[model samples]
Target chain A: MTNKLAKLIFYLGTLISLVLFLALTFDTHRQIQTLTHADQLSEQVVAGKRVWHKYNCNDCHTILGFGSYYGPDMTKVYWRRGSEGIKAVIRSPEKFTTWRKMPRLPLTDKELEDLVAFLQWTSEIDTQGWPPQDQKLRGAPGRAVTLGVSPGAVLFQEKGCFACHRLYGTGGQQGPELTHVGSRLSYETIEKVLTDPRSTNPQATMPPPMVSHEERDRLAAFLAGMK
Target chain B: MLLAYSSQRVAYPYFLVALLLFLLQVVVGTWLALSYAVTMPQWLVDILPFSTTRAIHTNLLVLWLLLGFMGTTYFMIPEETEREIFSPLLAYLQLTLLVGTGVTAIVGFLLGWTKGKPLLEIPFPLDYLVVAGALIFLFNVGMTVIQAKQWTLIQGSLFGGLVFLAVMYLFNLPFYANLSIDWYYWWWVIHLWVEGAWELVAAALTAWILIKITNVPRELVEKWLYVELGLFLFTGIAGTGHHYYWLGAPKYWLWVGGFFSALEPLPILLMVLDAWHYIRNRRAGLNGRLIFTLAVGMSILHFVGAGFWGFAHTLPQINYYTHGSQVTVAHGHLAFFGAYVLLNIMSFYYAMPRLEGLAEFDERRGTLAFWWMSITMMLMTLAFSVAGVLQTYVERVMGLGYMTAQAQMRFWFAILVVLGLSLLGGVILTVVDLLTLRPALAGAKKA
Candidate 1:
């Protein structure tokens, strides 16, 4: 009777071991699939990474919740700007004529393209609408935003608008208010104002033509809807 | 050879230089503050030379503090290590390099070779040389520690403080073309070195000075020293978080920045409490100007003013408005002047009598200068804080532009200018007391 009992216990232990092995194999297969789920980065994106690392860009400027807090966040840079506009700005920082100036570095064409690619990847990474401050023109008759775009809004944040301009009730007072910019100007006029902002007034302190066409339209619409 | 009495020989020269530097810093700083009030007066602008003056004010504060520290370290290291300083010649060389590099950097800044960065404003290649000088000093001190078998807790704190100061400085490199990035890392170097590491050194220095000067028990002083260092390490790391409140960081940082920064005062409080405990128990009747007392008091004030101001704006909600405003200047003034500068002054007093083998000097003069300087600095900080608040309300909250706000607050700015002049007067008085008056011991030595 004792011999029979021993044989039954041995058989049960073997069965349990086989079942555990099968379960481990299944779990390993699932982990492998999950690990491969992320898409492979293209060559352009890889090149951009090289430039970013070489410059130690991450040491100061944060992107997509990475890098240091020493400079302005660049996560939404691409969404706010297009490829050609960013290219121009990178080539000649004269595009960004503001009080807070970024010194022009001697970057090669290849390096600039890679940096832009990095910026492009940054702009698309779902920030959940961060840094969403608006721009308002003081004492303007109307606002100019229309067509589901907020040109003035984009203009405010992008131009470091808060540095000199204020929305509804906040920001520096060095410049005029722009809350009513959309109502005061048509889309084409807004475009003209953007290209040569000083054309409206010779002594105007405003900088000229920093936005691309699509961004200008979108930003104008956002401002128009502000009312 | 240990300077049993040779310290007296070096006393007058150091005091003279330190006093002159102090007075010059105060005058320049006051003039600059007044210019903001007076709408940038042409004569004042030309005389003060804003760009160069700013550099001088900051650099003088740094240099004087360093001179004091080195002088004290030269005396204290050998005593604690139970051996003479590794090389007195090297010590002098380090001082020469520091002064030489410092003068060149200041001149370069005036010529507009400024990296346009504060604190780390020196042109690129020179910065490396400064680092090299620091390494040489570190080597001398490190070798001295190894030769001496006596490695006390105080020595450990001092060594740790120096190492961290050097490490903090290494990160001040210009990795980005953006000036803001440069400023950010500059503060990391300056703030961490002064606010953080300096506090640790202060605790160690206070313990050693008190033990030597008074009847305080060595064991008790050592115990408090460890306690103070604990507080420093806990708060210092988190204290640097205050500088991160702005600079386009994520909002979540407000939690770490604000909460941890609030604790920065604890170490300083411990320092003050420990000093008081020692004084209370001592039987020496506290001879001389009680310079150590003033040093401890100033260190505590540093914690209150710099650390508190840091807490005030560290919250994202608050920093979003106060960033780059005069409130920052208020904090800067108190933190740098109140803590490190005052401690240096006190250290000078302690070392001066000992080095010169002079009789105890009049405590009344030092006590008076201490009170005058501390009070005036506190008042100046208050003025800046008030002006800063008004600026924030008018410029940010009220949605007025920068020019309009500046135009509106011309009167307050004028008052600040006048207040700044008073601060300069305080500096003059302190320098006079420190430099001109010799104790009876000096006469005895000459006789």
Candidate 2:
């Protein structure tokens, strides 16, 4: 029994030594930029991260391909949507999307700005080749000097049609895919469906959004761009 | 049968509930597997999302195994201490509260009331109930040990595991501040409990099985038990580095994590090889040789599935490519089945039928289930391994998007679904046999 106890002690000591080794490695691996100097998140950006967690965003979205596969990868979302686009969608998402999906968490201006910063910060992480081109928009070089988030794209997500309809085979499955919607529908029919779904299909469950004629036009042009 | 009558009585409630929940866990797991192979409807996806499915599959696994651990304690402690449990009434009450709260939480998850931490998604209020349940359990078992002042090595090891499990669970109580730090601490809870504490349970249980059936001297068996405990502490603690590689932690973890975790399999390898030699060379436990042989076989499977496949992905360089890929899924399935699933089943095999007063412990239906379940799980692991590697190459190496990569691996995922269903079938049969045998024992006037 004493011999076995001695062997046990010897093994425990060896294990404790490895723990120290792991700690030593942790200290050496600290990022100089984040831990030491100017690379830290600004006070607002830090608050935005808190907002991200507060709503349990990771439940629906993958950051670096770790979380749920329900929503799009948010690793480079800042680049995909831009600052203005993110704000418009978050501000009054119900006015923008189709389904009651992606809950509208009412955020103050400061919280919105912080969330954008937080997203921008995440976009800068060295994700090691995550979220290939499908998630990003690679338009022609004629549009090289890029602009803010497109209002159409914001409306598409905000209005929740994406929840019911697939775009290039990504969203929920109830409705026809919007990826080839432009090829199948003329501009007038697209407008008609947006303004009044029952006019196009008598059994359609879609409730027409209360947006004005101009917003309806913009939404039509957005659906037209899907092809 | 050698245990105090009270010990045997307390054990029945725990084993019965655990087996029923085990069936529920397998059914949910089969659903998650089938969803990957078929196109689930959009509205259905919205209601029972893949995340919800995955959460239910994984959490049910943890809950049922935890239930089994309590069963393990109730069954083993009295035998080890040579005394009856302090209170059988508390044991029954504890099972009702634990299983009731667990079922409620599972229902809550379906309705989308989750905190959304993967594997730890049992919400806040349920966490309190779990704590209360564990404490009540610990008190009942602790009271028994206090009443009987004799302490055995097997009981000591098991008690250590239970205490550590309760303590580690409290790590989830606090709200973490940063995502990286949150994940960093999360792995400590996950890795330590799986690789550290539960190992003590495995060792004690394996030791108990070997001691009862075999002619191995108590001195020799106890000495090896110490060695298993020592090795577990050595590897499981430092082996947690494998999880820290990409969590934005230190760079040296690449080497430190990979190297130490690579060594984690050494003890399992030793335990299996030792058991194999004893079984082949000597017929010490032939009276109940069938279950004894299976218990040995599971140790080998644990070594290969958890130990071997785990090392395959632990290397920092390999993980850099395979992180979050199907490869990790493959590892998780094999490791979990080989380690915890096999270990728990072996415990039930030892305790339940004997308690049911079967004239002979080796029933043909159960033996068939064991072989069927083990074979199908290995095939499923193979399917997962091939699919994961292909996914990493196509998605990470070729820079394809997630869905496109999933499309490329469709064939393997189909195989996985088929094998998963077969394995589920085997589990159902085994659980049914366990259920019916209890009544058979009662009718025979054995209890």
Candidate 3:
């Protein structure tokens, strides 16, 4: 093509694409408030964001799928770890031993609270189903059927029970083993433990599981049958 | 040296500082790769955390690349406009401000001071210095072009790209309480600078160098430059959508990002073909063999790393899984090295001999450095790609925990550390070769 034609194409194409992008940007701004639940953006969450930046968290962990990949994506972390778990980790990252170590930051209690609030707010944003559910967890119900176990077996996986409790020597060691819990405790006691670990032991570090009354019954029954 | 204008010497210090920073970046990058490969002791973690080191690594890349670009502009504009620079004092001052700010920022990061957005992590106070430096550069170049009252398309493209680059930095200055809003404009600076403004500058520089080495007609080279940059902006502006896909943006971005970014490779392909055609049919006597080879090599890798590798994941379907994984890391290393890093190094190779008053010099050491760096970089990219795919499968797909999956990927990280060390060796060889190069006994001196 001639130089003039190329120049014309360059100008026209750039102008058109830029204009379209601006238009989309405008529309995005309009829709983002509702999509991100902007009304829930509290002063504390905003402070939490500053805390995040001040500590250079994004350099390690990604939020909204932007930033470095050294740590786990924190987009859905609130749902996975809960407020207390997140605070505990941040309070003393060095204490939580893992394959990679998180630097211990000296954060005030208020900063920890704000950071959790920020993460909780992020968890509520509509990411169009990002951080896709793990295939193993998604397939747990089917595997439960294959194993002839109660639906609670699938619930155990979905609820991240394996992170703290072991049944067949496949889970974490922070919590007591439930392999023969049926012989040690009845279904009623098991249900109470699921509902309120603090009730069983005031010093319990486990946050109360966020299950419904029915889910607690099923989980208790599933554990009671372990014998 | 037979410089057309004495002021072109301003580029010399810029090139020197850029090379120093480039070497530093590689060293820090190697340390980072090693961190992933092996666990660090508590004392080291306390002193230099991964986050701090990572910030330094990336910030150094930006600082050095910008210096290279500025140095290149200083070298080219006086020749293009047929006049001396507007003010060498301002140019040197700009460099000092930039390098000073870079040093302070690195030190600050170690001291736990940061604004903490990924690439734009210079503390809030230092950012103003960066802006001031940019403005000074723009003013210096702008005045030089205006005083001459004569401009070529290549000169126009370079100046326009520089202006676009400076204006784009404004988007990075604002603070948005909402993260989605923050990232939305953040991509404006990060994405647009690379694909949009930087491409324009690359196209202009590539065109200028092609004309110098191949003795091609200026009109023909400028024509392709126009077409290349035209195609670049057409696809790249809308291609910013790709970054928006999982960042809590509107849903339509999926289609917009996927479709537009898929077309982004077309211009890079044209660039590869254009460079190939010009090199093949050039005049019988070839000068600056190292420069020619680097230029051609840069084009090919630009296509492979930025174009092909980027296309592999630009589509939302695949990126949905790969967005924050090592897949992005794989693409990032290659794309930056192939496009910007190689381009800057090519400028160094092209200008250094001429600046030293030599008509010709031995290309053997330079050629070896090129191949060593290139091969090791590609291998490093391959290692990251393997690690990325495995991480995605085991972690994202299989639902394994992050630490668990990372444990499995340690072998690949080990490989990356080895490749990085090799790459650093190449960089050292390059620095040694470039710094030690001299005219041979039989080499002709420039008039």
Interface RMSD of each: 17.5, 5.5, 1.6
- For model 1, what is the alpha-carbon lDDT of residue B25? 74
Q: What's the CA error at residue B124 for candidate 2, in Å?
A: 1.1
Per-residue alpha-carbon lDDT of candidate 2 for residues A57-136, written as tens digits (9 for 90 to 100)? 66556665566543456666665555655676666554434322344555888888888888777666543333443233
> Runs in model 1 with CA error above 4 Å?
A1-143, A147-227, B1-16, B41-52, B177-187, B248-252, B440-447
Best by lDDT: 3
Can you give the TM-score per candidate against the true fold?
Answer: 0.70, 0.79, 0.90
What is the clash tally of candidate 3? 0
* Candidate 2 structure quality by residue, lDDT tens digits, B274-305: 67655565536345444764777688789888
- Give per-residue CA lDDT, model 3, range B1-447, as digits (tens): 467889999998999999999999999999889889888876678678899999999999999999998998999899889999999999999999999999999999999989899999998879989999999999999999999999899998999999999899989988899988999999999999999999989888888878878887888888888888889999999999999887788999999999999999999999989999988888746555788789889998898899999999999889888878898999999999999999998998787777877677777788899999999999998999998988888877776577777888899999988898899999988888777777754543221
DockQ of each: 0.04, 0.16, 0.55
Where model 3 places Cα greater than 4 Å from the true spot, the runs are A134-227, B441-447
lDDT of 2 at B149: 94
Which one wins by TM-score: 2 or 3?
3
In terms of TM-score, the best-performing candidate is: 3
lDDT per residue for candidate 1 within B39-100, as digits (tens), equals: 44334333334545566667777766766776677667766776667776776777778778
lDDT of 3 by residue, A122-158 (tens): 9888887787742223343355446665768766765
Question: Scoring model 2 with DockQ, what do you get?
Answer: 0.16
Which is superior by lDDT, 2 or 3?
3
